[model samples]
Target: METVEDVTRMRLVGGNLALDFINTRTGPAAGPPDDDLLTGYPALIAWGVHAGALTRAEAARLRRLSRDDPGRADTTFARALSTRDDLDEVFRSLAAGGSPTAPALARLRDHEADALAHARLQPGNPFAWTWREDHTLARPLRPVVHAAVQLLTTAALDRIKGCEGCSFIFNDESKNRSRRWCSMDDCGTTEKIRRYVAARRTRARQ
Candidate 1:
C-alpha cells in the first residue's frame, strides 16, 4: 500500500535512474509486489522528482498538464508502465547471463531515440545532454531513457544485478562485485533474521 509519504521518502537504492525506476515495485522473491509506488501519472511525476530526474517546478508543471489532459496522462502512464516492464525484462535477462529479447530491445531503442531527439547538448567544461523544457506528459521519461542509454553502453552494464532477496534491480558497484542484497538495512537484515530463527528452530527440534 503506497502512500504520498512512501513516494516522497522512497528508497533510492538503485544507483542509476533507469535501475531505480525498475525498482519501483517491491515484493517477495516469487510473487506479486506488495507495493507499487507509481500508482498513477502523478505518482510517476513524484517519483521522477524524488529520483532527481525532474526538477520540482518541472514536476509541478507536468502534474498540472496531466490534470488538464487526463487522456494523454493515462496514455503516458500506460507507456511508462510498459517501459518499466520492458526495462526489467532486459536487465533481468542480462543479470541472469542472457540477452534481452528482440522486441524489448527494439522498444528500448525507440524510447532512447525519442529521448535523444528531445534533448539538447548543454555547453559546459564537460558538455552534457539535457532535456528541453517541453510541456508534455512524457517529460519525466527523458532522463530515464537517457540513463538507460548510458547504462546500456558503458562498462557498468556488466554490474547490473537483481537483489538476492527480492525483485529489485541495482548496479553492483562494490569493489569485488560481491554485494548481494539491495540494501543491508532491508532485505539483508530480513534474511539474516530468518536464517537465525530457522537455525534456532532446528536446534530446538533436535
Candidate 2:
C-alpha cells in the first residue's frame, strides 16, 4: 500500500495538473507501469495535497469524510484511477501526433462536464472558473478535470509531449520546444550515463 511518504516523494515533472495526475503511474514504455503511487483513497488525498490540487485543510476535511465513509471513498478512488487511464490514453495519442479516440474523448468530456457543473465563475479582470467549496469526496478531481479541459481546448494541446525517457507526459514550455526528458534529475541523468557507458565500451573495442 502506498503511503504519504511515497506521495511526497513523487516528482511533479508534468508541469500541468492533468499531466501530474496521469504521472501517478510511472515507468511505462510498451507495457504496464512499474509504479502506481495512488494505492488507496488515503493515498489519493495525499497525492491531491502533494500535487497542489487540494489545500492541506481541504485534504484534512476530505480525509475525515473518507474515514467516515469507506465505501464511497473506494468508489471515488476507482473512478479517479479510471479517469487517469483515460487521460493517459488521450494525451499519449496527442503526444504521438494522433487524435484521441472518440470513446476516450467522450469519457474526458464527461469528467469535464462534472467538473464544470460544480464550478462557479469568479468575477475579475479575466473571469475564471473556480470550484465550489464542498466536502465532497470527489472534490480533488475538479481542478485536474479543469486543467485537462483547458489543455484539450486550447493552444496547450500542441505543447504536450511524451518524455523520451519515461511514460510521463509533460507540457513542454521551453522557448525552442526542445524538451525531451521528463526531468534532468531523473530520466535525463540516467540517459546521459547510459550514453557515456556505451561510448566508453565502443572506444575500448576500437
Candidate 3:
C-alpha cells in the first residue's frame, strides 16, 4: 500500500513531467528563495488526467503499472519526461527556435503516438466518457484531448522548473523566493512547523 507521502511525491513527479514536456516554468513554487516548479513524467500524466486530456482507462493503466510494476512506470516516465538539456540542444538545432529531435523527444513523440492510437482504438467505447453527462456518449473526443495535452505539455516544458528539495516541477515567480513544496498550504507549512519545533527543542536543550 502506498502511503500518502508516496502518493504526494508521485503527484509532484507527474507535474514535473508535464513541465519538462512543455518547456515552461509556470507551475507551483518549490521553496523559499527559489520558486521553481517540480518536474516528473508521472506528474505530467496526472495533469493530463485531471485536465480531461487523458482517458480514465489510460490513466488507470498507468496507475496500475506504477503500482504493480514501479520499474515499468519509471522506465516509461523517464522516456516520456523532457529536460532542460533536451531543450537547449533542440532549440540550437532548429531554424526558427523550434524544438529538436532527440532520444527524449522521440520517446515523447512515441508516447503521444501511442496515446492517439489507443484513443482511436476506443472510438465508441463507453468507458472513455467517465465524466460525461451521458455515459454512452462515444464522442471520440481524442483529437480535442490530444490538442489539450499538446498545449499543456508545451506550456509546461517552457515554463516549469525542478524543485531543489523534491524532484517536482512548478512555476517559480515568488517575490521572496520562499515557495517550497508543491503546495505551500500542505508540505510547506508542515515543514515549517517541524523546523520550528526542532529549533525550540534545541533552544530548550541549550
The model with the greatest lDDT is: 2
CA-only RMSD, every prediction: 1.8, 1.4, 10.8
List candidate 3 segments past 4 Å from native.
Answer: 2-49, 54-101, 113-159, 163-167, 173-178
Give the TM-score of each candidate: 0.92, 0.95, 0.37
Give Cα distance to truth, residue 58, candidate 1, Å. Answer: 0.5
User: lDDT, candidate 2, residue 164?
Assistant: 85
Q: Judged by TM-score relative to the true structure, which candidate is superior, 1 or 2?
A: 2
Better of 1 and 3 by TM-score: 1
- lDDT string for model 1 (134-198, tens) is 66788898889879878988846668888889988889999999888999999999999999999
Local distance difference test values of all predictions, in order? 0.87, 0.88, 0.43
- Quick one: RMSD of model 2? 1.4
RMSD of 3: 10.8
Clashes of 1: 0
